[model samples]
Target: MFILVGITDLPWLQKLLFVLVLFFYILDVLGNIIIVSLVMRDISLHSPMYFLLANLSFVDICFSSITVPKMMVGFFIKNTITLQGCLAQMYFFHFLGCTEGILLAAMGYDRYVAICQPLRYGTLMRNTVCIQLVLASWLIGLTTSLVHAIMTSYLPFCNSNRIKHFFCDVKPVIKLACADIHLNEALLTNVLGFLSTSTFSLTIVSYVYIILKLMKIRSSQGRSKAFSTCSSHLTVVSLFYGTAMCTYLGPSSENSIEKDRIAAVLFTVITPAMNPVIYTLRNQEVKKSLKKLIKHEHL
Candidate 1:
């Protein structure tokens, strides 16, 4: 019921980790709060993209809230979670991760409509459409992770209970299974891989056409501005999809534990932290709305 990784390190290092993580946790919480607040207050910001961003902020808050607090607490106490506790964490963690993936895909589709088909963008990404897309994202994510979680927990793990890593990832936990996890591996490959890769590919294709559309513009300012927006999405998507593909899609081997661990930090922790920053820094509308909100608050 104990974790042994780096526990022997100096007390100061543990303190540093706790302090650093606390700082980031605070920042992420505040950032997401401001994002949700700004998006809600501004009627002009009621578009589909920002609506999706708001949902992502909500997801970001939930996703990090699930793991970060536990991780930070584990640094001090027993750091040992019960078997059922482990299963619950795995279920929710996988669930949120899958949900976030679908939200990203939904965001890509939103962008495709906005950028590629400007004339009919509003009609295509109407309120009802947005609601349905968001609903579908939630359902898909929940269903996908539920299957994996059930499949994993139902299997017998008689060999070892000591998970080397911090979080309860399905593959790592299943790896400890004394029973055959061939089905888990197959599900991971066929279900998780197919869903994640397809979304990632769709995002890539969306951006490609957006870039081509930007190229056809005559004015340099118009082209630069269009490319700039695309660039921001590209940056965010690259950080997300790159880490994700490495973690889930790449070869499943013993060495992949650390790889996924690192990737988890990016996709689960840092990317959520970056979502607000992405909009505030890159998108002019979000910045203007934020400024207006602050001014009104002061008034």
Candidate 2:
């Protein structure tokens, strides 16, 4: 039988990965903290769009925290993780992901309501409605992760003990199952695919309508001004969906390790770090409010 080995057996590469992972998470934390602080402190940002943006920033913070720190510690400490650690990591990892996915959809809907139904934006996304959406997103997050976790735990891991990457991603963990995980694989792929993709497609369609509406504006200045508002949101959406969908939809094999890792780094590491900067820097209203706040404080 061929010997099965993992990163624990390869010391040097793990150290390098550890440094890179820490750097990514540190950036994510710093950027997200700035966003949350700005949103909470600035009274002018108490609208639906900024509120959703704030919640999105919060989700990204929780999402990255789920995996990065443990990997950093694992690098200097024992490379091995306990079964309990594996399960906990898997739970929070997937849980935050599901929550973020739903929140992204909610964000898109918020944008859609703002752009397409401008007259009713306030009435449509009132405080009670926004709170309900946030609560529902959390509920969906826990429920989806619970299903995946219970399924993963019951699967027999008779032959191998090593997880492919730094964390216990569902796909990599399921691959190690000695039992036939084909059914579980199919269930996960189909359900999660529809969940993520349906929302993604809706987001794209919503933006298409938004751009169409912007083009109808009489003045070139009006059009440019309106389209500029969408620039950051569109960029964040593209980065997130592009990387995440590729990882979930693309085929995986031993030979695909490099590609998968690149996708993982983009989806889990880089994208979270980018969200806060994108929101704050691209938003004129936010920048104005922040500048005014700093000026007042200095005065």
Candidate 3:
């Protein structure tokens, strides 16, 4: 299917956007790679939280790769994707996006156990359990995305193949189908809603309890310390869920393409670029480990 991407008229605008997109893409890849490297090598960062965080960094790397590279190409070359290529992109986009959603929830739960159940944190979130949780997140992502991708890829595309928005978003892709897409719509709205909402709900519940537990700490220092551990996660969640919900949760209106595209950029591209920065800058332990890793590499 031939996909037209971005503002086509103004060459100047496209050039500017290409540079911006390339810059963000570079930042996302480099920052997440550093996080993964530091987390893996630093003995101090081998805990459950950092373990989940490393998985997140890896997810961010894959997630952005699914779309941003193609987007960068859109500015320079013929902005067309083959049917097979579009289907592949759609599948992996959902796969990695869903994985990141679940992993974020897992991270939230990790923080909950760390702060709320400090006494039993060891038994509750053992190495085996952490591995199980990580595996389950990927499994769920793969299963959910495979089903949706199969269903979507099979839909007859007799209509025009030009996708309205950039990339192979489910909604935009579905709109191109000439066949009655009620089922697709239902699945997109209800199934995706269920998947995203469920994980988002889990994250919310975890943080709610974490906040309540922090409130009980009598010492101001104690409360601050507990809150500090989770502040970065909360900020990341807000950025991710904010743009994601706006993009996916609502009704698909025709006029919302520009809005959707902008929101999509924030959700898919900018958020991933910012995640490593948010985690590393706000996290003292990560900073320390990063410094040590840099020094060791230099030596």
TM-score of each: 0.94, 0.90, 0.97
Scored by lDDT, model 2 comes in at 0.77
Ranking by TM-score: 3, 1, 2
Name the best candidate (by lDDT): 3
> Compared with the true structure, what per-residue lDDT tens digits does model 1 show for residues 91-121?
8887887788888878887777877898998
**What are the per-residue Cα lDDT tens digits for candidate 3 across 117-196?**
99999999999999999999999999988877888878889888778777888888888888988888788778778988
Q: Which parts of model 1 have CA positions greater than 4 angstroms off?
A: 1-10
Q: Worst ten-residue run, lDDT, model 3?
A: 1-10
Q: Rank the candidates by lDDT, best first.
A: 3, 1, 2
Per-residue error for 20 in candidate 1, Å, reads 1.9
Candidate 1, lDDT over the whole model: 0.80
- Candidates' RMSD to native: 1.8, 3.0, 1.2
State model 3's lDDT: 0.88
Q: What is the clash tally of candidate 2?
A: 0
- What TM value does model 2 have? 0.90
